[model samples]
Target: MRHGRSPWMIRLIVLVLRPLLMVVTRRDWQGAANLPEGGFVLAPNHLSHVDPILISHFMVDHGITPRFLAKDTIMRARGVGWVLRKAAQIPVYRSTDGATDSMRAAVQAVRDGEVVTIYPEGTITRDPDVWPMSGKTGAVRVALAAGMPLVPVMQWGPQEILWPYSKRLRLLPRRTIHVRVGDPVDLDDLHGKELTEPLLREATDRLMDALTAMMAEVRGELPSGERIDIHTLAKPRTTYKPKEI
Candidate 1:
């Protein structure tokens, strides 16, 4: 597989994430080889807004440039959004455009053999304990459609640096981000089957289980048996946030 990362951009990322990481947090990443050179789905739980930087830093350090599906509003943000656009990250809908456009693009990227990173939970986990909650089927759809591997990745300790839905940053003592990558999810059972709602949920739950198990290993505790899907339960009456990647 051809490495699509630019040498100059890689050097720039290292120069940026290296010193900043040294001061902000320590990292423990396992299963680098789990991410193949060829196209694949990277499914990781969302912790803080800064989660991408840490994971992207690790991927670049391992010599792969990942493309993430970002919210359109985020793509229109001030400085960082500009950087995201310039780096060619894909954009998705928040309350505006439909999600079809982004999924089409991501599927194409996977077909072209680019490493596509997706946070299964469209929004950050609402799990009080920060365990991985339920996932939408977008990631699984893309992987199955493209005949690519769906890699399950879990990260702990980023929430310690910055909590969810908060603006506070705790860089005082410096934290260590525990990142684990598991083998490709077993989709062999679902392959060639019709893409029914039940099938999609099964595939998605398989993904969530893989992530939750790895997360349990990292934190040395089991995740909540009852998953918290904030999108469905948060309102339940009026509006439902679009199922997204």
Candidate 2:
């Protein structure tokens, strides 16, 4: 467990951004008590690019340091890369480190007692309604591999700040970011079973369903039975796609 500059960097951001966000974004956080004291998975629906920062504020406030698995190419950027590296964020090597390599890193992060946040969909949801779409199996592998709980956390209103797949940033009116942290998804039965394809799909589906339900609760509406499956619906490729080494 290499302790990078995450300690000070997280505190620094929270010290500054927390207050600013308080004034700019109203918060509705529930089920925070469900967050375990040790290592765990903080899986959330992908709504905006700024979700990591927003959710970081939420988890950090609850004393959980978030470790996100990002793309390796994004780590080569001029400034953002530096911050990610400094904060010890995991970079998924889509074509280099192998498929399960990032999983290894994430498992290690969870074992190290840091909350690892994964977008089960692997990318932002393609659902036109901004609801939680489909999910991948990465989160399931990490949680089961590390023997940690997979906590479903959902957030709304970040789209109000920065709409998904859009460049326009609406920050004047101070939108309310509604984040609801729900109980950990029950993976005991699936975890004990063989890590098969059908089992993985079932596990990931349960995870996304939990998140989608939470989002519906936050919105006070019912979600559609059909959710967008990113792997098939719209392949929003990342900078570098991780492949098996």
Candidate 3:
């Protein structure tokens, strides 16, 4: 797979953030060999807001530039939006007519040999114990549409630096972030099948199961129960305030 040059903005951002990340966190990254050549979908579990930074650090070190599917609100933010655009990230207009447009753009990016990182959980996990929760169908749809490998990249320890929904950062004690990239999910059997709701749900379950299992390996324990489905909660966990378990 041929590599295209990264935008100047991406280089500059990496030049600045890479050093800071190296200082603030130690990495226990593995499975670099599992990253396939050329373009593919990278699906990682969402733990904290800082996940993208740490995950990007890993991908960059392995010579892959990751394009994230960011929320449209962030894409429209004054300073941040400009940076994201300049860095060549894709914007996702959630719950809008433009959502389909965003997915098409992502699939094109993969076909063009760009690694697109999609957080399967869509948002930070609402699981009280910080385990990966159930996922949405976006990642599966993209991988299926593009006919590309869907790789599961599981991570832990970003929450130690910044807990979910918390505004504080704990940087004194440098944390060790653990990331493992699993082999591409086996979807060959379902590739030519119709993209039905049941088919999508099955693919998503396989993706989430792979992620949760890899996470269990990193955390040294299995999840206490079934993966938490955020939609089933009594109250939507949407605020920045840390929720009580």
Candidate 4:
């Protein structure tokens, strides 16, 4: 991605585009005051393509534009890549051994007073149930490593924009999106510790717990303790065929 101030053209585009987006989507962003003043990870559940945009667009009044830690593949398109680059979004390659570099970049962004948003689930949920799947510890690690607070963000209504398990992108009118930003998670006790898998997982569980609480609040459901166990979430499933053959 290229590095430079967004051209006047892009600024004008945003000026026109954002209002149009608000008008089209009729997004209602709650808990706007909960947004952190500076750089931090806005970790939210990943359900639809519009999740990031919904959260970020509403928070534009908060003074900092939210940047995403998108997988490097999204930049493959010549046109799309150019836009993302100009917008200063960070590219992250999870499969490569150098994924740590992305974390470092996020830390730097925070130090520079820029907000970085990430979906710790890595990708959207593929579970038969819509519950949040086990999230990677990258968000926790980044928070601890950067010595920055982790803000838990819970958003819904984007799912209404596009149906689950469907390839269709629904952009029709009258769909309302809700974004709820929670307070910054204090990880001061966990700061400066050795970055081990267990430590990271523990911190992540704390964050997810907060996220689930926020999600429940947004969805108007009772908060329960049915969290997924991250340790065993990735075990391969085995299938057995009948012996009729």
Model 3 per-residue lDDT tens digits across residues 40-63: 999999989888989989888888
Query: Which model, 1 or 3, shows the larger TM-score?
Result: 3
Q: lDDT winner among the candidates?
A: 3
Instruction: Name the best candidate (by TM-score).
Output: 3
Residue-level error in angstroms, candidate 4, position 108: 0.8
Q: In model 3, where do residues sit more than 4 Å from their true spots?
A: 233-245
Q: For every model in order, what is the number of clashing pairs?
A: 0, 7, 0, 0
Task: Record all residue pairs in model 2 with backbone atoms less than 3 Å apart, i.e. clashing.
Answer: 94-241, 94-242, 94-243, 98-245, 99-243, 99-244, 120-136
Q: List clashing residue pairs in candidate 3.
A: none
Clashes of 1: 0
Name every residue pair that clashes in candidate 4. Answer: none
lDDT of each: 0.80, 0.80, 0.89, 0.70
Error of 3 at 242 (Å): 6.9
- Give candidate 4's whole-model lDDT: 0.70
How close is every model to the real structure, measured as TM-score? 0.88, 0.90, 0.94, 0.83
RMSD of each: 5.1, 6.0, 2.2, 6.3
